[model samples]
Target chain A: MNQSRNRLVFLALILLGIGFVALVRSTVNEYILSIINFVGIYIILAVSLNITNGFTGLFSLGHPGFMAIGGYVTAILTFPVSRKSMFLELPQWLANLEMPFFPASIIGGVCAAMMALVVGLPVLRLRGHYLAVATLGFLIIVQVLITNWDSVTRGPLGLNGLPAITNLWYVYPWVVVTVYVAWKIKFSSYGRSMLSIREDDMAAQCLGVNLFRTRVAALVIGAFFAGIAGGLWAHLVTAITPTSFSLILAFYIVVMVVVGGAGSISGAFIAAIIFSVLTEIFRPLEENLDVYGIGEIFTAAILILILIYRPQGLFGSREPGFLLTRDTQ
Target chain B: MASSNSVLLKVEGLEKRFGGIIALADYDVEIRPGELVGLIGPNGAGKTTVFNLLSGVLKPNQGRIVFNGQDITRLRPDQNAALGIARTFQNIRIFKELSVIDNVKVAFHIRMGHGFWKTLMHTSDYRYSENEMEQKSHEILELFDLEAIKDQPAKNLPYGIQRRVEIARAMATMPKLLLLDEPSAGLNTGETDELVKTLRKIHDTYGLTIFIVEHDMKLIMTICQRIQVIDRGRMLSTGTPEDVRHDQRVIEAYLGKSGHGKQYAQG
Candidate 1:
């Protein structure tokens, strides 16, 4: 009976999502539609980062590096052949290549996950602030590498005028997938081990949890989705640059996770939408209203207030379902 | 007493040093299957160090640790757990943020039968394994009378209850040898008596080989059949509780080298 009820809820959610997508696509106002699309992308980023930072209790600040990897990989794969040729530094074999958005994004995500696997092996061993610093260093390294790599990345000028392939349709599905995967992981045995490590590493290890393997797995999974979010962002803006995936962007993503309550996927989703919308609404104020940097200052203030008043964030790590339902069964 | 032939754990010539100070030196112990042993020493006697070494929290500089006939001297903590050893901490280390049931479920992680794909897809195999884990966790919780508070966060529980949850979590790992460090450290006399009853019940039900490091003499003396005493990182005496109770070295270690040793030994 419970399984049937769950299936019913799943079907309803899919139908609702399709209806919402149709409504957004049919709407004539492009600006509002783009803002909604950005929210979906941020949701993906926040939820994925939460898997590592909140669920696994690893304070990683390397999402921007993985995003840059995804953005560049997708941009390179999907860029028109005619435009690709404009870059004289591009290799002859690569300059003519162009692929569908689907395959490019998949490759982008896979590439980011691969990087996470390589870096996480050594870096995930460090805890707390050290891990954060190490991951931030990774971001810096990626940024520097991208800045220096003149042939593919266009030497910090970044790729521009790429196909506008991302929309609400492309992004919302990825959000659903990210949320689903994260929710599944949170309840799984592996996720339990991760949580135990977060609570007490020595106790977790003594309970047969392989610390290195679990930490690395969390990082890789998180990187995979962050990469996908990057692909969506690159396509939505029709541009890619090293500065696009900066430390500031990483901070925004971290703030989303913190404000959403780290371990709660629903919390991340809600916080992502609210913060993205708030930033967009404040963007015009910063430009036309002569209040430069107001959006950033406001966000920083909100983050500080939330940390001071609700250290566990809005939801305090409890899932929406858990809050609604009293009994576990 | 169980025969030496059925020994579940054997430690020999164990040595650990933190710079100049020797934390443990020439530490030796043998625990047979189904034997309840107590390791007692005053502050800085390396009682907790022995637990740490046995459970693979720390590696000994010179030693051989054989557990269930396997040499686990260089094994990591997870490897030790996989080889049928589990432990609790001197300080309560339950996952405070997690639910009481989840505290036990996390320990059951090693035994989960589902793969990553099954878990992500929520396949029937995943459900089956999850249900089994929950049932097992419930059973363990029930054993500690924690079923009523199973849904509460572990941190919300009282100290005594949190200690019980830690033991339940440790047991969920399905260990053959259980090492508990100061399980009764912060409990009141009433809680300590209840803990003794619970420990006795756990030992009898699981038929486990338990090695406990405790400062509470009354609790350890009542429960442990044989006790090992250490002083300043060296073995002072090893015998039954009654024998150790009256041993001159054990008495001297606890009451000092004055006439109080004899006076205390009389008790």
Candidate 2:
């Protein structure tokens, strides 16, 4: 009872923090609310990806590919009828189309999840290097498809004039719910089995874990959330481009999980926020100092520093509830 | 306990080949209920391969596996597990990164009754299941004398204790049959003796039907009620420990007619 109460108090504290931030945004003309919104989206993506990559021990390099599918689908589906009407080069069917925002967003997420399942069925059966290469190849294939497909994706020209619908209201609640779901999973038996599989697949298999089913479950789940994050990103930016969800995005998500601590869900949460803030704080520098790909250089340097210094990001594998002695399970 | 004279596991003309070499060929054995059966063979005798096939890790290009009187040839490994068959590895295989208790809890996952929503909601059923698994894992660990180290990471335990924990984790699932591969391997004489005692106690106490692959003949002779001797993947003979000890065919299979197999066995 005390532990459950502690969890409640912690949840209250997190809500308090988010409320304080939103209050501050409403009170002051601060420029960082957008950064926090980005952090929430990345947190959703990072925590979701960690479910598969960290917990299930599946090296999924196609996260950005799935995210891209979600972003593009949601962006196109939620494109206001006015904008759709304006694009003459677009198909007559698309120009006359109108998709309600929320349902379109969820459909976008489901599309991405379905893509994950379709790809995962064959790709996830492999192990180690083979799995990595297969996912990486899938990412490249998706990117190429998005770039070359002119009718729906608008080719390299990309889609623009999307509604900026993600605000403090949408992001905070979504982040909380996603983290809570992930926390529940981490403590649940499915989570335990997934973690055991991470530790040793052969051992887990002997203990009644179906490897294919487990991996697919984790993959579909993680991809579903990543897709949701993509929906948020598509609306928040008011533009959709293939380049946004690319290999570089994949690398960043990996950094969020690795620097956070592969086995730690909260680690991903904290690291995503920190990394997202750092990227924004350094954005001007990145734009001006594009000297020899300074953005990659800066990210690589931060990653190296984290690896050499903190090792397990801010939270490690210890959950916030455990830090407060709330729940043991 | 005598194996009810009723077959639990049957292998017939089972063969495994790796490219140019045949690892197991024309192997057959039957394990019955409530029997402490020993599978003993030389290093290259394909004893482990037989275990692998029975456990459904490797598919025989052709063969049928019937468990609990149900044909399960096409069943996956987890399906085999659900049907009350559990196995340990020849080399220690545990979820080394997890706590010992958590390792056992993982084995009890199929017992979960709650859906994803219940888990997500942290419902009463979810909490009950989690606590039940933890308590049961603790109880089983205690039974194996592993309670003190339940919080310890599995890899940190000593080899003998790790083996015991593996069996304990397997038993946590309440399997009808247990397969232990080299459970006594890498143990000192003292550890092996304790292992034999533990095995005998578990068999007598729980009435567990166990099939073990061990090179430790002393432990086998002391505890296993029956021994199956195999050479070149074919069963040389199956009998009581004493009967197999005197069988000339078993002697020649292990001794290669050098006339020193019995002396080697006495250690």
Taken over the whole model, the C-alpha lDDT of each candidate is: 0.89, 0.82
Across residues A1-329, which tens digit of lDDT does each residue of candidate 2 receive? Answer: 57767677777868796877679678755366677778889999899999988888898888988888888888887887786655525677766777876777788789999999999999988998899889999999998999898877888878887888877677777677777777778777888888888888887887898888889989998888888788888888878887888888889998899888887888898888877887776777767786445656677898899889987666555566544443353
In terms of docking quality, how is candidate 1 classified? medium
Q: How many pairs of residues in model 1 come into backbone collision? A: 0
Which residue pairs show collisions in model 2?
none
Tens-digit lDDT string for candidate 1 (B1-267) = 456588899999999998999999999998899999999988999998899899898999999999888999999999999888999998999898999999999988888746557788888878888888988998998898999989898999999989899999999999999999999989998999889999999999988889999888888888999999999999999999989988888888888888877665544
| Residue range B1-267, candidate 2, lDDT tens digits | 444777877766778887767778877667788878999988888898887888888877666667767877767778888888899998888888787888888999976635466788778888898888878887888888988877777778889888888888889778888999989888999998888888888898889899999888788888888899888867788899998888888878877886797766654
Give DockQ: model 1.
Answer: 0.74
Worst window of 10 by summed lDDT in candidate 1 chain A: A320-329
lDDT of 1 at A68: 92
